[model samples]
Target: MPRAEFDKPVKVLIVASPYYKDISDNQIAGAVAELDAVGAGHDIVHVPGALEIPTAIGIAERLSNFDGYVALGCVIRGETTHYDTVCNDSSRALQLLGLQGLCIGNGILTVENYAQAAVRADPKDQNKGGGAAAAALHLIALTRKWGNSGQSVGFASDILLAGGKTTA
Candidate 1:
């Protein structure tokens, strides 16, 4: 996997849901290792479940100065429809936040069973947690590439004024 290189160390926040303690621990381990390898500093914050991961990151984004966020959790299918609700809603929330220009990586696992969750969360296996961290780093790199130009899309102020149009 291609990774972004940085001359200065970046800071990241890992928001994890510890509903499944062992699984969450493993995922956290993988994410931490990846951040360490890239010399990025990180801090971990635990929430109750998958749905809370994005909320925590949103709070941190407003209150802290993290360069990016890694969201980690596991949602296993159960006998009820609650599973679907949790999976879809959590994913959607993360996607929405990303669209709003927040650098967030969704690592929450939505699987049919515990076995499937284990394999994906394991650092020695798919290492999805680490992959999430990498995703956030890549986004941070892109944000840095653009810097803060404060330019907006659409017609320039002068053009809008000429047409007797105003932007409110």
Candidate 2:
């Protein structure tokens, strides 16, 4: 069994969006494989759709012991604005968690149509879940480093150092 030894072992919650069960399943499977590669401890939870991801995330955050989170979902665009709402809201929520050093990896997909969704939903060609898991690992590393830093660093400062720059 692969195992990772962290300065502080983190409990992670994988909140999967159940909107598109098939896609979500693929996402979860990939996420699990990635997590297994890192040998990190994790639990899986299911939500109705992308909209509910944040609520689940909030629960994980409040647990106060988890080192990070991974959000997995698929939202194929429809004729309505529903797609926009779910995608934006879910992304923002994860960003908020990241800002708080919650170390969340998001694998939610906003596709133009079912065909495109299907393409990215493939476990082989589309490994967004794995990408998200890797992101979580990096975030965990960053958080551990910043927490131990003697110098006080703000959230924006951390983001900037993490190779993120604001475009204005």
Worst 10 residues of 1 by lDDT: 153-162
Measured against the true structure, the TM-scores of the candidates, in listed sequence, are 0.88, 0.80
Candidate 2: pairs in clash: none
Each model's lDDT comes to 0.92, 0.78
Write model 2 residue lDDT over 1-168, tens digit each, in one string: 223346666667888987788788777777888877667888998988887887888887786577778888888888899878888988998888778667888888888887776667666877788777777777787777777888764543423334567432
Please write out the lDDT profile of model 1 over residues 1-168, one tens digit for every residue.
677888777999999999999899999999999889889999999999999988998899899999999999999999999999999999999999999999988899999999999999999999999999999999998898777457766764654456688664
Model 2 TM-score? Answer: 0.80
Each candidate's clash count: 0, 0
Query: Which candidate tops TM-score?
Result: 1
Candidate closest to the true structure, highest lDDT: 1
